[model samples]
Structures are given as C-alpha cells and as structure tokens.
Target: MDELIKYAKENRRLLHQVPEVGFTEYITTYLIYERLSQTNFNLYVGDDALDIDRQVGLPSDDVMANTYQRALDYGVPCSFLEKLHPYKTGVVATIDTNQKGPHVVLRFDIDALPIKESNEIEHVPFKEGFQSKHDGEMHACGHDAHAAIGISVATYIDEHIDELTGKYTIIFQNSEEGVRGAASYAKKGWLDDADYFLSGHVGTISEEVGTVGATATNFLASTKFNVELFGQSSHAGSNPQDGNNALLAASAIALSLNTIAPHREGATRLNVGILQAGQGRNIIPDYAKLECESRGETTQLNEYMFERAKEIIENGAKMYGCESKITVEGFAPSATCSKEMIDIVKSATVSNDAVKTIVDEVSMDASEDAAVFINIVQENNGKATYLIFPYHLKYGHHHPSFDVDEAVLEVAITTFINILNELK
Candidate 1:
C-alpha cells in the first residue's frame, strides 16, 4: 500500500509539470503510453480506439501541429507520435482473463484546463518543485491525480491478475474538461459490452479527506458553441453606413442571450465567455466571434436555452444585415447513477478501514463528459455509477490555486481495487 501511494504521487507530480488542454494532450498521451506500455494490457491508441467522426470541439490544425512538435521536442518517440497524429489523443487498454465473468469498465479523464497556475511559494506544488512548466496551462481540475490513480490501479490489476476473474477495460479519456472527448468513444459503442461501469472525480462537492460518495445527482446538460458574424469593412469616418457593424450586432446578441428567461421547471445558465471584434479604431469591424455556452438541469431545458440563444444570435445578426454562423463545439446530456451501482460502491468499500464515511449521494450541479459513458452503459442494461472521492481543496475547480490533498490519491485507488474485487 505504501509503495502504491508513492507510485501514484510520483506519477501525479510528473504529470503536474506538463499540462495540456483538451484534444491536444500530446505529451500527456505520450507519458501515459510510456508508463502503461510496460504492462501486459492490450493497448489501443488514437483512431484504433475512437470513432474520429464523432469527435467535436477539436483544436485548429495549427494548434495540433504545434503541440505535436512540442511533444517531439519533449523526447516522445516519433513512432509513438505517429499513432496520435490528426487530433486523436485517447488511450484504451483491456485485459482478458479468459474466464466467464462480467466485463467491467473504468474511465479516467486526462485533460487539463487553460488557466495559468499560481506561482506562490506557499502552494504545495510550487514548494515541491512540480509546478506546471507550460505557460497558460495547468491541472486546476485534478485530472492529473485521476490519471495517476488510474495507472496505479492498472498496475495493481496487472500484478494481481491471477486473483481477479473478470475481463477489465480501462479508458484514459481526453478533452473531458470541455465535455467533448467521451462522445468520440461512447458514440463508437465502447461501453456496449460492459456488465458494470465506474467513473468518478476528486474533490467535488465533498471536502472531507476520507469520505467517498456513492452517487451523483443533478448533472447539468450543456452545449458549447461559437458564433461568427461577418459584415463589410469600411473606413469609419468616410462610410459608416455602408459597413454593417458586426461588433454592434454581437453586443446586442450578447445582451439578449444573458436576458433569456430561465426555465421554470429547473435551473438554466448562459454565458458569453469570449467576444472578440474590430481591427482598428478607424475601420468598421467586419467580423466578430462569440464563444458561449448554455446549461440546464435537464436536457429539455438546455435545448430551450440553446434554441432561444440561437434565435437571438441569428436575428441579431440579421438586424444588422450581417451573416451569422453558429457552430456547436461540444455537448453533454443530463445523467443519473443507478441505485444498484451505488449500493455496490457502498458495499464494496464497507469493510475498508481507510474509508471513514460512505455517503449515498451528492449534488454534482455541474457538467461532466463521463455522463456519455455512464448513460450508454445504463441504456445497454448494464449498471454504471459516477462516484465522488472528496479531499481537502486549496481552491475551487478551474481556479488558478486549485490543488488536492495528496492522501486522496491512495483512497481512490483502494476504493477502486475493492470494487473490482467485489465485482470479480
């Protein structure tokens, strides 16, 4: 157990030093491959593990090329780099015991956020010399710890292969931060063969170190989209009327979007996170771009918000005689955990001394791409659940100062090992 904790910690710190955003985790993928390749698991990479056509919200081609080049400079083998080219960045591994039993699948997200890290000396990572090396990228959401726990569990399973009976599938998913990556695999029917499925997060609603949550409720359905408005550019002083003002159109649309009525049935949210327009003070802006998203407690409500948002954007652009293009970059459906799986999680760790408390459920009140995996498994008549293992957090998720208590890493690994044993 001590050695396992050490292994998880080492991997987590190493991952912390190199953070990458969704759909472009080149170095992240390379490091995971290097660690898991030594084990006996049957590994699948890139297009072999995903249906690329289903993927959305991918970075631009230039961004992908630069990230791949960075990975090469970081010493990733060219042969391995070839496997992840063309915007594929997920890894899946499976082990068959050749015994008749359940097929259990476990998923772990491996993408980082775009927020820059705090360089304060008091922060544990900064104090320990493992602060992020990449500018404007940090693991502010604990995915690094999730990936480490996953690798630790995989190695544990490999060492105890003779003691476990069921066929096991492990997924290291990418682009989960934006709710984009899971669909690539889920739509490909990756979870169709599972008898049992499990996935979760760290330092969510709970804040106690030894607490484990069995189920999550109220996962918000969400859609991320980008809008571009185009108009003719002209000199502001000479021909203001001839040039349609895309910037003015975008401003009106953003105001109307924020004023959309919330669904009476449940909570709804909308945000225009980014709005860029205009080239110079003397020239009329010919183009404007808006990065926005809508969310709701349920899918129907989310559609209400999205549809209304679209109407506002389109009509707003037309009101200014501008062309509008709205593209959906990512989406996640609302989901809930099965009671049977929740009970299993509770029973699996009931005897573990490390787990001090087992809560039946908690309000997630956020979006998670893991819903893609959980929903598919349940729809196929298999049991699935998204658990929460809480820890002391320095700041809220996606914040620059966000960090997790290292002890939670071991708790997560131990809990999964117990659950796997129970299923076996």
Candidate 2:
C-alpha cells in the first residue's frame, strides 16, 4: 500500500508538469502507454482502441502538427506519436482473470484545461518545481491526479492478480473538458458488455481529504457547439455597405442566445463563451466564429435550449445576409446512478481505513462526458455509478492556482482497490 501511495504521488507530479488539452494529449498519451506497458494488461492504444468516425471537436491541422512537434521536442519517441498521429490520444487496457465473474470497466479522464498555472512562490507545484512546463496549459481540474491513480490502480491489479476474480477494463480517456471523447469508445461498444461500470472525479462535492461520495446524481445534460458566419469583407470607413457584416450578425446571435426562455419543467442554461470576429478596427469582418454551450437538468430540457439557440443563430445570420453553419463539438446526456451500484460503492468505502466519511449521495450539478459511457452501460442492463474523492483545494477547479491535497490520493487508491475486492 505504501508503495502504491509513493507511485501515485510521483506519477501525479510528473503528469502535472506537462498539461495537454483535449484531443491533443500527445506527450500525455505516450507517458501513460509507457507506464502501463510494464503491467500484465493487454493494451489497446489510439487508433486501435477508439472509433475514428466518432471523434468530435478536433483542432485544426496546424494545431495538431504543432502539438505533435512539441511532443517530439519533449523527448517522446516518434514511434509512439506515430500511433496517435492526427488526433488519437487515449488508452484502453484489459486483463481477463478468466475466473467466472462480472466484467468491470473503470474510466479515468486524462485531459487538462487551457488555463496557465500560477507561478506564485506559495503555490505548491511552483514551489516544488513541478509546475506545468507548457505556457498556456495546466491540469487545473486534478486530472493529473486522476491519471496517476489510474496508473497506480493498473499496477495494483497486476500485483494482486492472484486474489482478484473476473476481468478488468481500465480506460484512460482524453478530451473530457467539453464532454467529448467518451462517446468515441462508448459508440465502439467498449462498455456494451460491461457488467459493472465505475468512474469518479476529484473534489467537487466532498469538502475534506478523507471524505468519499458514493453517488454523483443529477448530472446536467449538455451540448457544446461552434457557429460560423461568413460574409464579404469591405472597408469600414468607405465601402462598409458592400460587406454583409458577419461581426454584427454574430453579436446579434450572441445576444439572442442568452435571451432563450428557461424551461419551467427543469433548470436550463446557455452561454456564449467565445466569439471571435473583426480582424481589425476599421475592417468590416467577413468571418465570425462563436463557441457556445447549452445545459439542462434533463435531456428533454437541454434539447429545448439547444434547439431554440439554433433557431436564433440561423435567423440572425439570415437577417444580416450571412451564411451560417453550426457544428456539434461535443455532447452528453443526463443519467442517474443505479441504487445497486450506489450500494456497491458504499460497501467498498466502509472497509477503507483511509476513508473518514461516506456520502450517500451528492449533486454533480454539472456535465460529464462519462455520462455517455454510463448511459451505454445502463442501456445494456448493467449497473453503473460515479464516485467523488474529496480533497482540500486552494482554489476551485479550472482556476490557475488550483491544487489538491496529495493525501487524498491514498483514499482514492484504497477505495478503488476495495471496490474490486467487493466484486468477488
């Protein structure tokens, strides 16, 4: 157990030093592959594990090339990068005990946020010399810790193979920030045969280092989309009338999207996070792009909000004589944890010495791509649940100074191991 703790902490810090976002996790993928290669699990990486046709929200070709080059410069071998070339970045490992028991699937997300890390002297990572090396990326959401726990769990399973029954499938997912990536594997039937599916996140509900939440309920359904408006460019000061003014159309759509009426049936939300238009101060912008999202307490409500937003965007573009296109970057539907699965988590937590409290239920109140996988497993009549490992945090998730108490890693590791034991 002490060795697992040491392994978890070291790998967490190592992952923290290089934060990559979404589908561009080149260096991150290579490191995960290298670590798991020493275990007994049969590994399926990148192109082999995920369905390429199901990928969403990939960056442009130039961005992919630059990130791939960066991975090379970071000393990652081209041989590994070649396997994940052009936007394939994740791993799936399976070990079949062939002992006549349930098949368990565990998921861990490995993507980072685009936020830059704080370099304040008091920041733990900065002081410990493990802050992110990349300028515009950081694991502000504790995914580094999640990935570390996953690696440790894989090693633990290998070491304790004699005592465990059934089979284990561990998924290291990428591009979870926008509720993307999981669908690729889920659509490919990764969780179709799963008898028990388990996944968790760190520190959103529980407030203490030793607390564990057995069930994360009421996940909001969400849709992330990008809208592009095209128009002719002209001089603003002279021939402004000749241009269709895509920037104006974008501004109108952004304002109209926020005015969408809330559904009385449930909670609803809409936001235009990014809107880029107008290349210069005096130029009538010919192109505009807006990154936006919609959320609801239920799937039906989310569709209500998204459909309304789409109508506004299309009409707003037509009003300005600009052509409009809407593309779905990512999506996740809402799901509830099964009582059977919730009991399984509680049973596992009760035996863990590192766990101080067991939360029967907590509201996620947010979107998670894991819901895609969870829904797929449930649809096939398998039980599934999402757990939460609470830890002390200096800042909320997605903040530049966000850091978790390393002590929580022990709770996470033991809880997962105990859960496996319960399945027997």
Candidate 3:
C-alpha cells in the first residue's frame, strides 16, 4: 500500500501537469493506455463491436468516427473493442476470473472542463509544465486524478489476476460533462449482467484529507436546457415595438426563472450559466439564447421544478410577444446508494485508516453522469454505490487555479486497491 501510494503521488503530479478537456483528452488517454498496458490485464479500445441493438439513443456517425480516431491515436488496443450506438468513445475491458461469481462493473470518467489553468506557481499544473495547450480548456476538476486512479486500480487487479474470482469490467468513459455519455452506455445494456456497480469522483466538496464520502446517495437529479427566443427584426429607433424584441423576452425569462427556484423545497438548485442575445445596440435583437440547468434531490422534485421553469419561459415569451424554443441538451437521473455496497467501501476505508474523516452525509450539489450507472444497475435489480475521496484543494472546481494535494492521490489508490481485493 505504501509503495502504491508513493507511485500514485508521483503519477498524479504528472497527470495534473498535462490537462485535457472532455472527449478530446488525447494526451491524457495516451498516458493512461501506456501505463495500463504494461500490466497483465487484457486491453480493448474503440467501441467497434458493441451491441447497438441494446443502445438507447443513437449518436451520429461523425461523433463515433472522431472518438475512434482519438482512441487509436492514444494507443488503446482497439482491434478487439466493441462498437455501440450513441456512444462516441466507450471502451470496455473485461477481467474474467474463469471461476464462478457475481460480475461487477466499475466506471471511471476521463474528461476535463473548459477553463484555463491558473498561473500560480503553487498550482500543480503551472509547476509541472503540462498546462493546457488549448486556451480556456483545462482539467480544473479532478478528472485527471480519476483517470490515474482508474489505471492504478486496473494495474493492481491485473497484478493479482490469478487470485480474483469473478468478472470485473473497467469502463473508461468520455464526455461526462455533457452528461450524455453514460446514458448511451446504459441504453446499450453495457451493464445488464452486473451484480454490483461502482463509480466515484474525487475532491468534489470540501472534506478532511483522505476522507471518503458516500456522495451519490444524496445527489440531485438534473436536466440541461438550451432556450432560444426569436422575434421579428426592425429598426430600433424607428419601429422598436414592431421588432418584437427577443432580447427583452430573454431578459424577462432569466429574471422570472428566479421565481422557480424557491418553489421547490429542500436543496433545490437552478442556474443560468450562459445567455447570449443581440448583435448591435442600434438594431432590435431578433434572437436570444440561454443555457440553463435545474436540479433536485429526487426525480419527482426535479421534474416538478423543471415543469415550473417551462411555464415561466412560456409565459415570459408570450408577454414579450416572441417565439420561444426549449431543447433538452442532457439529463441525469437521481442516485441512491445501496446500503450493502456502501458498507463495503466504508469498511475498506476504515481498515486502511486512510483518511482523517469519513462523511456519511450527502455532500455534493453538482450533478454527475455517473448517476446513470446507478439508475441502470437498480433497474436491472443490481446494486450500485458511488463514493467521493477528498483531496485538499486550493481552489474550487471549474476555477483556473483549482489544484489538489498530490499526497491524497496515494490515499485514493490505496483505498481503491483495498476495495477491489475485498470485493473479490
């Protein structure tokens, strides 16, 4: 465990140095494949043989083509990889034990956010010299850590493959931030035979160093929306009223959305992240657009709030005499942890004395596509649990300065290895 921790600390520092964003994580994926292939595990990449018959929502061929190219460029063993519809780059590797036992699936999401790296010297990326090449795109979230930890776990399991006694599948998923990746995976029945499934995030909310929290148990379900308002265009000075004023309608809709927030009780959240309208001040704006999200701890509450939001937008557009279009970009169902699975993870953490604290409460407001795995598992009568590991961070997620303590990476590696052993 001590050696593994040390290795993880060093590797995590290197991963932090080179940040990649979302599905285009080329260098990051290459590094992961390079490291994992060195172990005894059988590796496969590029979804070429996936049972599309089981796929839920089908993505375009162009998306899948780009995904395959990325995987191939990264050196993932793609010859045996399965292809599935709707998933651009979903890679699955199975560790078959040959012995009879329940199958388990573990998922790790490898994607970065769109934020520039902080220039601070103390910030890990700045010091490491692998900061993002693409401006405004960085691994501000701890996804680099997630990918590294996934590799570490796979390596550990591969090293002790002979002693393991069940089917273990490691899924390296892409595009979790868009929240559409996991749903596509689920629709394809990727986890149809699993007895237990697990996924997690690191450094989500503030907690003591090495702490592991059962976050998904209380996480909120969420929906992403893109709203477009259209109106007739006319000269602002000569006939402002005749233009219909789509910008005005968008502004009114944004303000009225605040009213929907307080209507839901108990930890409801809503935010309008992006709003764009108009080209010139002299011209009456003919079109306006908004990207918004809403969430709640339960599906029913989330849906209720979402409905109210729709009503607000509809009435606001009517009042402004503009046409409104609402499109759902993505959606993730709520997550609830299984008591039995939670006990397994908790016991592993306690046995190692890895962290200073282990939080039992739900602690994250941000949504996760990992929640999709929980939904699929439960629907298939299987159990799933998602956990969080706390790494001391100087800045919050999505911030350019966001950085994590490298030492915590060791704790996560140790915890994951122990859990895999115990579960086996």
Candidate 4:
C-alpha cells in the first residue's frame, strides 16, 4: 500500500503536468499505457476500434489523424474497435478469472475540460512549467487523477487476478465532461454481463484529506437541450416592426423556463449554458440558438420538468410569432445507490484503519454518466454503488486552480484493492 501510494503521488504530479481534454487525450493515454504496461494487467486500447476522425473532434483533421496514429502505435489488444460514429473515444478491457462467480464492471471517465490551467504556485504542471500547449483545454475536474486511479486499480487487480473468483471489466470512457460518451457503451451491451458495478469521483468538498465522502444514494437525472429559433430579419431602424424577433423569443423562453423550478420537490436545477444570436446589433436577428440543461432527482420529475420546458419554448415562440426547434443533445439517468453494495464499500472502508471517514448521503448535485452503469446493474437485478474520495483542495471542481491533495490517491487505491480482495 505504501509503495502504491508513492507511485500514485509521483505519477499524479506527472499527469497534472500535462492536462489533455476529452478524446484528444493522445499523449495522456499513451503515458497511461506506458505506466500500466509494467504491471500484470492485460492492457487494451481502442476497445471500440473507433477511427480517429470518429473518436475526437478538433478543428483540424490533421491533428486528429496524428492522434489516431499515435493510439494505434500503442497496439493495445481488444476484440473490436468500431469506427461507426467518430465523435468519442471509447475503450473496454476484460479481465476474466477462470473461476466462476459474479462479474463486475468498473468505469472511469478520461476526459478533461476546455478551461485554462491556473498559474498558482502549488499547481503541479504549471509550477513545473508543463502547462498545456493547447491553450484552453485543461483537466480542471481532476480527471487525470481518475485515470491514474483507474490504472492503479486495474494493475492491482491484474496482479491478483489468479486468486480472484470472477471476471472484471475496466472501462476507460471519454467525453464525460460534455455528457456525450457513455451511451454508446451502454447501447452496445458492454455492461450486460456485469453482476456488480462500481465507480467513484475525487472531490475537494469532503475536506478529509484521505477519506471517502458520502456514498451517494441518489443523483439527479439530467438532459441537455439545444434550441434554435427562426424569425424574419429586417433592418432595425428601417423596418423594426417588419421583423419577427427570434432573440426576443429566446429570451422569453429562458426567463419563463426558470418558473418551472419552484414546482419540483427536492433539488431541481436548470441552466442556459450557451446562446448565440444575430450578426449585428442594428439588424433584427434572423436566427437564435441556445443550449440549456434540466435536471431532477427522478425520471418522473425530470420528464415533468422537460415537458414544462417544451411548453415554454413552444408557447414563447408562438407568442413572439417565430419558428422554434428543440433538440435533446444527450440524456443521463439518475443514480440510486444499492444498500447492499453500499454496505460492501462501507465495510471495506471501515475495516481499513487508513480510511478516515465513510459518509452516507442521498443527494449529489452533480450528474455522472456513470449513473448509466448503476441503472444498467439495477435493471439486471444486480446491486451497484458509487463512492467518492475527498481530496482537500483550495478551489472547487472545474475551476482553473483546482488541485487535489495527492495523498488521497493512496487511500483510493487501498480502498479499491481491499474491495477486490473482499469480493475474491
């Protein structure tokens, strides 16, 4: 455990030095492969075998080509790599134990956000002078840690696979930040065979340097929407009344959307993230587009809120005499933790003297595509749970200065290894 912790600390510093965003994690993925190769784990990359163009979205095709070539260079083995749709990079690896028992699936998100790195002195890559070369893309959400932690767990499981009693699948998922990655895996039946599923996030909120925070029982289900409005364009001064204002309709929808929040019980959230309209202020906008998200603790409430949003958009457009279209970009289901699985994780953590805290809470405001896994498990009549390890940091998640106490990595590694041992 001590040696693994030391390894994680050293490796985490290196990973932080070079933050890569989303499916464009060419260098970061290579480094992970290089590190994990030394361990007993059977390394696999491009489990879906997606072509570079389909996996990563960049402004330049040349860059995507190069990244795809680099991933191919690693030559990780897998059964298939589908090149069907090329927007996300997804990988799946299977570790089968000859012995018969329940199969388990574990997932980790491997994408970074489109934010700049902080210039803080304690910020690793920045202090060491290895900040991102690609200006705006950074691992502001601690995904680099998630990747490392997943690798550490995979390595540990690999070394101990001979003594284990079941099969394990380690998934390296891409595009979690944008909420567009996991659906394909779920649809492809990647998790169909698993009897149990587990995943965790590293948060700065727990404050306990190396403790596992709340075993969250329920997380809000969320859906992303892109709305486009069409209206007649006319010169503002010359013919103001001749134009139907799409911008006006969009604004009305945004304002009226907030009215639905007070109607829901528990925590319901809504946000309008992106808005683009008009070329010039002097011209009545011909088209307006807005991207928004709505979330709720259950599917019923989520659907209800979504229906209200639809009404707002439809009615607002009619009132403004403009045409409107609403597109659901993506949807992630809510997560409800299984008591039995939570007990397993809690028992594992409590039994380990090194674990400082074990929290049990029902609500986590943030949404995870990992929830898709939990939903799959429950649907299959299996129990599942998700855990979080609190790593003390000065700033909140998705912030530029976001940094985690590296010591928590050890605690996570220990907890994962212990859980695997107990299951064995």
Candidate 5:
C-alpha cells in the first residue's frame, strides 16, 4: 500500500479498536479533532454546535461515564473532553478563504454498533491486534473509515485553502446508526447557508470497488421510539389479583404493533426490538420498557403508521390496568437525490478510468437521517446528494464479521475533494 493509503488504514484501525455507540463517540471524535486541530480551519464540537434538544438515543449516565473513562484510558486528553463537557458529542469545522463562491458542506458519520465482535484467530482485525477492546460494542459499520476520510479531507483542504475559492465545512456526525444526530445539527442551523451539501457511505449498496452511487433512490422515512409501561407491583402468590402486570401490557403492545395494517399506497413496517420488565418469578413486575421503530416509503405513510402505533401501545397498556409513556427518539424523512448534485459527483469520478462504473442512481430503501439534511438544504435553494461509495465487503453491514477493504478510503478522499472543488 502507498503511504497515504497506509496512513488512512492505520487511522481506521486505531478508531476501530475504540468503538463507541451513538452520541458517546468521545474517542472517535478526539482522533479526528487531533488530526485536524492543527489546521487553520475554525472548529466546533459538542453543545455549542449540536443542538442538545434534538439529540436522541443517547446513552445513560453510567454508560456514558464508563465510555468517557475508557476514552481517557485510550489516550484521549481530559482537556479535550472537557471542552465538550455540557454535551455528548458532534463536530463542525469550517475553512474559509474569503473568496466569493458557494458554501459547500461535507458530512461524515462517526459511530459504531452495539454488537460484540468476533474473536476468531482468522478474523483480520483479531489477527492484526486492532480489534475492539470494548465488549459488546464494535465498528460493524464503516463509520471508523468514514471519520478517517473526513479528517483526510480536512487536512488536505486546510493545506490548500489558498488554492481554492469558497468556504468548506466538514461535519463528523455522531449516532447515525439509529438515524440520529443529523437533525440536531440541522435544527440548530448548522447546515444553513449552503450552496451545496454532500455525504458518502462506503460499500452499502454494492461491494464493487470501482462503482459509486452518485444519486440514491427510494429513501424511506422512519421514526424510532421508546416506551415504558407502569403498573402496581405485588407478590405473585398472595396478591396476584391486586397486581397490574406491566410485562403483560408491554408484550401485548408488541404483538398488536406488529399487526398494524401496512400502507396500501406504499410500504410500511413496525418492529419492537427490545422488551424489558420484571422483578422476579414470585413478584409481579411493575415496570416494562420497549424500544421500537416504524418505517414507510414516504413521510405521510410513516406518520400513518406512527399514529396507529401510539394507539396500540396506549390501549394495550390500559387493557392490563397500566399506563404507558412513549417518547419519539429519532426521525428520518424520505427524499430523492438531486440530479444536479449527481452530475457533479459523476463528473468527479469520471476523471479516473479505474472507476469502472459511476451509477447516477441506486435505490436505498433503508432510512437515513442524512435525508433530513438533504431536504432542508434543498429547501433553502442548495443542492445535495448522498453518495454510496462501494467496496468489497467480507460481511454485510452491522454483522459480527463485518469488514471492508481499506483501499477504498483513498478513492473516497480524492473523490470528495474533487467534488468539493467542482460544486459551482
């Protein structure tokens, strides 16, 4: 591997070893900030930059404390975390040359999944000794590499700001796995005043190394929610009749939610991933919690499903003489990529023949919070598109064996730089 590729790969491994989930990406954030902090670009992190009100799916205090201490053990400076103290995490750095041109924003997600990684001797990371150190958390997604690319772009532009016109903004977003984070920045006006906005996800649609998804299609809208059911606790054997079992309420709600009618006009989905409640076999549980989500091809369709979900959860709780509390954690809006933005990405990739194919469009039925940024930017008369950069993947995203060829990081860095310069 060339020096540049090797550098990027090393950075990815370092980040991969310290995987964090959602808004608690202190270790990942520090690495990027450390690499780009030396540049003249103005940097923003945490509370001031990310709207705390809009941030969702954050870890509990105990979990956040453990991760923060781990980040310190991993060599992240205490002074650094102190700067972002009041908030969890987010990143926005701007490089301005005082030239007259469109303001361009480049975004990248930097977070991991809550999955225990494989420890087999044959696994590349395990063999190479850069595997995740945190149990039950791993960089099953390519966000580690994406953060490296974001730093690379920041470094390159900071060095060449004199050669370029216009202002460039780089965002190292947090908690993208559950479609959270982007809205926090957007609602705070962090993405406003953009002439163009662009983002890329590596190896998602197809694993062909030379292909690039210039424009994504069929993006779905979704909502993530958390519910808690409350009931009176009592001894099972002696006071069974006096108990209102929250577990029963939560279980019934989960079943009813899955049976909600699908939208005839478009696709609709409901899933309840987590259900927790109970004290012991001999005691009637008074509390139960659930994590659930709904999705649809369009925003309206998703709204339709969400309404029914609330009803089911509420009525189901009432059936068991319990009360339900539901909170909407995150939301993603369906949207289509702009043709003009795709044209710019296509133009950038076509310059290199090694890029065998540049697809103008590809369907991404999976919901993405980035769509919120795209839609808001477009609404303000700015152009935007989500680029799907491909690579050869050993396993599907979010799997225990998930891994990608590191060689694609260089291509991503170069393509992003070229696109930033070409967005006129």
Candidate 6:
C-alpha cells in the first residue's frame, strides 16, 4: 500500500510537469504505453479508438508539429509517437478473464487545462518542483491525479486477473477538457458490450479527507464551439468604407449571445471566453474568431439555447456584412445514474478501510465529458455511475495556483480496486 501511494504520487508529479491539452497528448500517451508495455492488457489506440473526422476543435497542424517535437524533446520516443500518430493520442487498454462474467469499463481523462501555473513559491507545486513546464498549460483541474489513479488501477486489475472473472477495460481518454474526445470513443461503439461503466472527478463535491461521494445527478448538457467571421480588409485612414469589420460582427454576436433568455425548464449558462480580432491598429481587420460555450440542465434546453445563439451570431455577422462559420467542437448529453450502479459504489466504499464514510451527495452544477460515456453505456442497458473523490485543494479548480492534496490519489485507486473486487 505504501509503495502504491509512492507510485501514484510520483506518477502524478511526473505527469504534472508535462501538461498537454486535448488531442495532442503525445507525451502522456507515450508515458502510459512505456509503463504498461510488459502488462498483459490488450491495448487499443489509433484509428481503433477514435474517428478523427468526428473530432472537434482539434489544434492546428503547426500546433501538432510543435507538440510532437516538444514531447520528443521531453524524452517521448518517435516510435511511441508513431503508434499514436494515427489515433491522435487516445488509448484504451483491455484485459479479459476468458470466463463468463460481466464486461466493465473504467474511464479516466488525461488532459490539462489551458492555464499557466503560478510561479509563487507558496504554491505547493512550485515549492515541490512539480510545476508545469509548459507555458499556458497546467493540470489545474486535477486530471493529472486522475491519470495516475487510472494507470494504477489498470495495473492492479491486470496483476489480479486470476481473482476476477470478467472483461476489465480502462480508457485513457484525451481531449476531455472540452468534452471533445469522449464522443469519438463512444461513436466507435466501445460501450456496446459493457455491463457496467464507472468514472469520476477528484473534487467539487468532496472537500475533506476520508470522504467520498458517489452518483452525481443533474449534470449540465453542454456544447463547445468556435465561430470565425470573415470580412474584407482595407486601410484605416484611407477608403475605410471599402472595408467590412469582422471585429464588430464578432463583438455584436458576443453581446447579443449573452442576452439570450434562459429557459424555465432548466438552468442555462453561456460565455464567450475568447474573442480575437484585428492586426495593426491602423488596418481594418478582415477576420475575427470567437470561442464560446453553452450549458443547460437538459439536452433540449442546451440545443434551444445554442440554436438561438447561432441565430444571433448569424444575423450579427450579416448585419456587419461578414460571413460566419460556427463549428460545434464537442457536446455532452445530460445523464442520471441508476440506483443499481449507486449501490455498487456504496458497497465498495463501505468495504474499503481507506474510505471512512461514503456520501450520497452530488453537485451537478457543472459539465463533464464522462456524461457521454455514461449515457452510451446506459443506452445499451449497462449500469453506469460517476464518483467524486474527496480532498483538500490549495486553490479552486482552473486557478493558476490550483493544486490537490496527493492523498486523494490513494482514495481514488482503492475505491476503484474495491469496486472491481465487488463486481468480480
């Protein structure tokens, strides 16, 4: 147990230093493969795990090139990168016991938030030398801990296969930060044979040591998108009438999009987080990009909001005489877990010595891509549930100073092991 804790912490620390976002997780994939190479698990990646055509909001080719080179320079070999190149860095590892039993799938997201880490010495990550090495990328949301726990659980399941009689599957999912990656895996029919599905996030519901929360409900369905507006450019001081300003089009859309009325059926949230336009101050901007997201308590409500927002954007673009393209990069449907799945999590938590108490509380005020996986599994009549592991945080999620206590990794791994043990 001590060794496992040490292993989990070390893995978390190592992963923390090499933060990658979404589909460009080359270093993450290579490290996972290298560690699990000798294991008996049958791994699935490349075209087998994802459909790149369906992938949304993928980084540009130049970004991929820089990311690849960055990982290579960080010690991830080209051979490993080559294996994942076709798949765009998604991975799924499976181990079957051959005997007739249930098919279970465990998912863990492996992506970092796009935020630079705070360099203050008081921040634990900086104090410990585990600060993110990459600029504008950090595991501020604790996915690093999630990845370590996922790998540790996979290793344990493989080593103890003799004691289990089922197909144990672990998915090291990428691009989950924007809910971009999970749908591709789901679209590929990975959940067709699943009898049970399990996944979890590290915080938000659990804030103290020795506490665990099972079964989140009322998850917000969401859609992430980028809208690019195009117009003709001209000199600012001369013949300005010849130019159409895309920046005005995008700005008008942002202000109007926010004013879209909320639905009475459920909660709705919208934000335009990134809006970029213009080149030189003296030149009329020909192009502008707006990155935005919307969420609702139900899928229908989200669609309603998105459709209205789109109309506003379209008309706004036309009002400014600019062409627009709205691209839906990712989406997650709302989900509620079955009682059967909740009971399984409850039983596992009660039987584990590490978990002092199990809380049934759930906060669904936010969105998670795991909703995609859960919905797919449930659609096929498989029971699915999401858990929340409790821990202390030095700063709130997505903050530049965000850091989680290393001990929660223990709770995460043991809870997973106990659940597998119960199921087997």
Report lDDT (CA) for all predictions.
Answer: 0.90, 0.90, 0.72, 0.73, 0.85, 0.86
* Candidate 6 lDDT: 0.86
Q: What is the lDDT of candidate 2?
A: 0.90
Candidate 4 Cα errors over 4 Å, as ranges? 34-85
**lDDT per residue as tens, model 4, 125-219:** 67777555556767788777887788778877777778888888777777777566677677667688788887888884646765675367567
Error of 5 at 27 (Å): 1.6
TM-score of 4: 0.88
lDDT of 3 by residue, 364-422 (tens): 66678788888788888988878788766667888888877666677677776767777
| TM-scores of the candidates in the order shown | 0.98, 0.97, 0.87, 0.88, 0.95, 0.96
In candidate 4, list every pair of residues with a backbone clash: 22-112, 48-81, 48-82, 49-81, 54-86, 54-87, 55-86
lDDT of 2 by residue, 77-117 (tens): 99889988877899999998878888999999999998989
After superposition, which runs of candidate 6 have C-alpha atoms over 4 Å from their true positions?
Answer: none
Model 3 residue 388 distance off true place after TM-score fit, in angstroms: 1.6
- Candidate 6 versus truth, CA RMSD in Å, comes to 1.6
Report the C-alpha lDDT of model 6 over 222-311, residue by residue, as the tens digit.
999999999989998987999999998898999999999988898999999999999999888999999999999999988988999899
lDDT of 5 by residue, 1-424 (tens): 1454566788899989988888788888888887777899788887666878877776788887877888788888898888655345768899887988889888899999999999988778998899999899999988999888887778778877878888888888988888888888887786789888888888885567778788888888999999999999999999899999999999999999998887789999889999999989999999999999999999999999999999999999999999999988888999877898777877876776546678888888799888988998899988888888788777889888887677678777777877876763
Off by over 4 Å in 1: none
Report the error of model 2 at residue 238, Å.
Answer: 2.9
Candidate 2 colliding pairs: none
